[model samples]
Target: MNTPHIAASRRTGFFSRSGVRRLAVALAAVPVALLAAGCSSAKSSSDQSATDVINKLGAVPIPSAPQTQLTPSADESHPQLVAVGSAVAVTLPSGTGTITALGPTEDLPTPLPATMPTQVAGTITLRVATKTGTVKVTTTDLSSRDDHGNDIALTPVGVAQAAATAGGTADFVVRGTFSSGAAQITLREDGHVVAVWDFNIELD
Candidate 1:
């Protein structure tokens, strides 16, 4: 029972079983490590692709806008003269009106001087007579333009009435200041120019 041959055989069989267990564990771990490495590589590639797309979008450009032009009407060709103490007659849809006076003044009537002027002051007075039904007049119906085709600012100074009935007369006054250049005053009704007055000045 205690023979050397029998003990040598038992030791060899135990060592062989231990070696087989170790080898099986190592073989199973190889697939798990490879799967983890594959997942890491795929995640890195996806992140780099996303970054490339973002960079491409950032490299694009933009655009801008355009401009336009303004054309004058036919009535702008002819203009009336401005003479001291004289009147210019203008025809309207309902009747006619006389631009009775236009001159430079030091003191404007009450409510006519909306703002204190930094330069000389100018005033325009008109008497309108209606032939048919009543005619409506408003401050917006009047405008003035400078020689450079720029609109001269105007403020309503006074008015006798908003409307003039048939056979009735109404008075209106507007005030502004010139900028050392010629100016043209205009009246518009139904989007058409009814009258235009021209004033030329040369200041010494």
Candidate 2:
């Protein structure tokens, strides 16, 4: 996939003012307490969905009875703000270069991360290798969906902006909180992820 291949695209509807009015009218018809109770119950059920991925990743690298859940559960529809994409032609800031090849996590060169913990927690410096001419780079947030079809938000630690050169490496060190289990971090531009990093973080 040279030019970034997007998974299947689905059309999501937005909530308009009229739609809100209708929903308000419908809600007003029901007892407020019942509505509150229903919402609370839904929240409780969804909270557990995120952990399902972490547990499964640990038990089976590949699930025997693997079930895929769309991010933002298909049941509870959410409008997609816009077409997910990276900043087009978002070049490096200043004193930054392009990404060529990533180097090793410890000692990196190009297209490689400079430093990363064998595991990660809060925030850390993430490095990538490109050319000696690299500078003015930034790493963006990562997004992934779990088994429950809900989007998991991830933040990078470094620069995800486009490098100075067409081919260079960069490191993104974003703060993140993950449970003890298996997961992958995706590189995002706009709302889409273009790259990925897979690892496991033990909850300490």
Candidate 3:
């Protein structure tokens, strides 16, 4: 009888419908997977952008300096000398931070002082990490003194302001016009000297 044939056809149709449903489910999941991947890529791009901003702070050409001294000493006044490419950790009023001397740059100071011409220029990167509350650090909080007892002027470069909150970090770039000879970079927070680094400059 035709009843048996009908039963066979119905079974085949059921399997076909089930397979189509499975395919639909798989197709629906693809967009979600792609969206997740896109989110990850976006985060990576954002992190890279942060680094780019820091590098652009020294976009101008830098003259070569032949010497960098980072000798450790027992004298409490001068603990350790930080090399040009090295980083030093410091205690912040609100949290902690690391300061790195990115080395000299040719970016001269604006409107060169008629009396005090700039002998050298340099840049430094500061990273602030906070866990308790929001904290802000700026180039204005820094000072530099040359071996000749000259006070070098410090200024903020790209992304001038750095602010961080709980479990967050911020990057800041600071540029300064230094005099000839070795110089010292100092950081002051809340009217207290918190950190320091030395740089030696040589010119042809």
Task: Find the candidate with the highest lDDT and give its number.
Answer: 3
Q: What is the C-alpha lDDT of each candidate?
A: 0.55, 0.37, 0.59
> Which regions of candidate 1 fall more than 4 Å away from where they truly are?
1-101, 104-118, 159-161
Error of 2 at 10 (Å): 38
In TM-score terms, candidate 1 sits at 0.45
Provide the lDDT at 116 for model 3. 51
Position 29, candidate 2: lDDT = 44
Deviation from native of the Cα of residue 173 in model 1, angstroms: 0.9
Ranking by TM-score: 3, 1, 2
For candidate 1, which ten residues in a row score worst on lDDT? 62-71
lDDT of 2 by residue, 47-103 (tens): 444345434552222212212323221001221221122111222222222222121
lDDT by residue for model 1 (64-140), tens:
12112121222223334444334545455555444344554434345556664444566666555555566555678
User: Residue 3 error for model 1, in Å?
Assistant: 99
